[model samples]
Target chain A: MNAAEIYKLSRLAIFWLSVTFGAVWVACWGVGVFIPSLITGKMPFLLQVDNPSTTVVFIADLLRSLTPILSLLVFIPINAMFMVLFERRSLALFTVRMGPNRHGFDGLAQTAADAVKLLFKEDITPRGADAFMFTLAPIIFFAPSIFGALPLLAAVTNNHDLFKVANLPTGIFYILAAASIPVVALVMAGWASNNKYSLVGGLRSAAQAISYEIPLVLSLVTMCLLAGTLDVVEIVEQQKGGILNWNILGGGALSGYDKLAPYWLNLVDTSFDTSAMFGQFYPVPWLSSIMAFVLVICTVLLFGLYLTGACAEINRIPFDLPEAESELVSGYNTEYSGIKFAIFFLAEFTNLFVVSSIATVMFLGGGDNPIPKWILDRLPLEPISNALGSLLSPLIKDLMFIDPATFWAAFWVIVKVYSIVFFAILVRGTLPRFRIDQLMDFGWKRLIPLALILFVVVVFARTWVVCHG
Target chain B: MEFVNVQELVSTGVAEALAFYFIAALAITLSIGVISDKNVIRAGFLLIGVFGGISGLFFLLQAQFIALAQVMIYAVGITLVVVIALMLTNPRLQNEEAEEEAIASSEPALLKFLDSIRNGFPGLVAWIAFVTVYMAIRSEHWEQSTQTIGEDNIAVIGRALTTDYSLPFEFASVLLLAALIGAIMLAKAEKVEDTDTPREGIESGSN
Candidate 1:
């Protein structure tokens, strides 16, 4: 076959190979999940209990737990592939032209196709490179991308639980701590490549990560304090009373009608006992609500900054200074090629997901169903249920197979994650790349101080509520 | 209050020993690399690795907070600043060849002195000093101290910073402010005259 034909053939082969690789990873995860009893001869981590039927329950729990992560591990690359396609379309739209219209399913698989092209492309290791460190950097950078997903796993319930890979007491802190390692790897990559632009990009990344990380940690700490626990599940539980109960606004009494009026007013007016009357009659304490309002606003502001910072950290568009093709000639990956380059690309996409997922969990009431409990209880059940009794009952039973609360909880989480991903894509489409100095100034001068102030305000509010209440 | 488990003690001992060995190895290797590496930038990178290894050792010791601080400040913070400085400033102009030549010229003398230290009078003095210190510390059977009141560390730390450490903190802040102001001044550009030079001597002096 000619060179062009051979190239096309290899492209197809690589595409199938990636799909198969993703499938195998998923299959391995599934088999490990479903046959845990057969493999381990003991209960899986999820199902371990004090009951006699623990092993049976454990296997079931194992499969249940495996589904989300298995899906996540498989779906991340696919999503990343979509993200690249979306970027292309977005760029096309920006330049006012139709882009990739001829590709698989109207440019849907364009990213996957690009991945195949990248995989088969000539892999070059630059001369005078530090081969070992360069090789190791991508692996180090990629490992944390998987581990970073750990804290995103929601707990089974609002109670103290062990639902993550490592049920670290300082769950959020552990995540922040582990997340910093990728910055090191990036710097290493830049340094090892022996390229000036790569070195500059790496330095910028390190500075950006350092500057934004302070706020990210402090803001999450504020959430943790509001939740009264560092556990992700507990944090979600703390937000259970819907959006009002979410710690972004404040928790408990400070959250709802109580914030509308002082204690004296509540005692004076019996009608103000219910939230509806309070909503109508008692005006929200403009000043106190300001505190909660500011907290939410700052949280969002910091989250936006974080999203931008993460783009920079991962060397993606707008913040893709580290790999700016026009200026830096691929930045930190200037000398990387083949599997090593693939790993860096994989890490970048995974990090995009990681940051978005984190933003979702932190600012967006993490896995909380917005449905108020009273509505669920007030649903008309008898006649509608009786008319289609058998079928509806079984269907309802099947629907409620997973606890309704848990189902809704996971639903909110998925929604939040997707929303954040959508935002990331929007950011990629809209913003232009920032200069290195501008990036640093934005991070340190603007973001870090704002995070510090927000953290202090949150602490003061918590203390004030506790002392007075 | 209670006897420690032998197994736990043994495991902890091994872990500590391993950690120490790794730290020592990393320190030695990096020091060697700093002295020997022809590329100055590569030496700086090696120095970063040394910092990271030390930070990892801190983590293994269960000092998670300290480990994070070390990574945040030293490994990433100071190292990056130093690397940036290395990149901005011409390394070749700043003792690059001189450093290599210095090492080469000093090699024989350094090796001879190291041999002497390894085998002679200083080694005897070091052994004696070590034994004396070990015996002195080991022989001291001080009474077990107990606190009458539980210390709230967070409050104590905050109070200490505001009180005893206040002066130092304030001084550090002032120093940082001054540095920032100086940087600003240095970065500010001045207009030039028609002669392709500054209107005043100020610009030339600043440059």
Candidate 2:
């Protein structure tokens, strides 16, 4: 609406974002750098190449595994808290109502208060529920979100060695496999609750997930094929240098275009045969150019297909049929209370964040400046860069508290991820829930076929031209 | 600080052995629970654990792709469908039907004998399979390969599948396509009014 209200929302977002980022940075530094060095001499894990004691090596190796969980443990709740508040406020803005403003200044502290209340609330197991599975359900649901996102750490952090332990050779496949796991938890929660609505919700979720996972998996698989690598870091690395090199922008179709860009941008007059160079890049001339154009369109559609499938997979509106209140009375987790409910709530948001991060890494250029390097190099950004570098120098060098690349990587990732998150929330506000039959029909008939066609098109089209990885 | 050779500490070490035993124990326990548990759905859920433990063993063996595939396919996809099918079908009705058939026909002496123990027929079959595999393992001369399967094993596998194993891969895909087509044929509905005999019903208009 008005400029003043917009200003207030921006300010609110800044406050919560800083709180999350600041806390996360401190925790990562502590686990990844400080505490380990404090315990086993003042050498960093980065010095593993240097001959170190078994204790030092052991602690370093151990902390590498711990780093993902530790960061996630710190990140999830705060991020979820911010997301919930942001969602409520944004949704309220859309619906023309005040949302949770009574708790704290303009509702900045509302989700924090809600989170505390949830933590202290009574944990209830419904009568006739499977007690063991009922208790284990939330944990099963929540655990995968942490481990599933570990590979992304390397991708997001630009393949920093500290997070290298999280990088698997199978990469996105591992994450997809992990993503498949949470449905079982939902089913368990549904069955253990011994509620009719819960069971229906659970079965619907299984059917939906099974249907939608095809397109989601295929879309990502198509990207992997185009990129020529399954490794997340390699995929991200290939999309580096500029927005044109990014997977979304014709994938590596622009790579040939990319080489000739800097010369034009810098206003260089080449004595060499530019036409011949162009011919060299595109051997078949018109046919190759057309194939490149086709690949670009296919990739864009595949990305949309991914978002649609991912929306259903995570049970977000209009695909959130499993938890539709009208039909299933809050669905599978309806019977859960207190911390368990909080956990399911937290994991759902974290899943959203993880999905966005995957989108950021695979589709969007993770941490790469949208402006090409030559342009960015020529901009009047040196002073600001130097000033920030100086400010972070102590943390970067003396204490090894920050890696500069990781810092900027983290920054760009945040910007890209949160934009996607905001878009998802906007979508939630806009769409109506799909009927169960309609949902399945759309997933299987529309999205899967479209995804398959796009995948096959990409498979053939990529061979005629160079691709990112 | 005390130091140990990194290779000595990890490869063929106590940790690996311990992990192997732990996963094996978990798998055995879950497999037993899959059969012995009275509640069939619960047993189905335990089957997930059995598959997961085996995947964990695969992880230890450094076959990450296979391990993840195991979880993705068998543990979640096949098992969940199996459990759902079991839930939808009436076991009591099946048992009654089977007993009736046994009574109606000339029941095999071995079938009656095997019915005495709990899950006797399947258990005996499983034991025989396990013994055959064990005997095969014993007879074979096993050697550790000098080469290490590095992180880029996926690329190597991909290359081999397309180059050397392409024909077999194509054959497997053809087999799957046949199965898929057969399933669709079985499930497809017909125009009820056109058909005779089995199609004679009140619902003549139903597809």
Best by TM-score: 2
State which candidate has the highest DockQ: 2
In order, candidate lDDTs are: 0.63, 0.86
Give the lDDT of residue B55 in candidate 2: 98
The list of candidate 1 runs beyond 4 A from truth reads A1-33, A39-79, A86-108, A154-162, A210-231, A250-254, A258-290, A293-296, A375-407, A448-469, B1-38, B93-207
* Docking quality (DockQ) for each candidate: 0.17, 0.46
**Per-residue lDDT over A158-271 for candidate 2, one digit per residue giving the tens place of the 0 to 100 score:** 888778877888999999999999998888898889998988888889889999999999999999988888899988889888888889877788777777776656545656
Worst 10-residue lDDT window for candidate 1 chain A reads: A156-165
TM-score of 1: 0.69
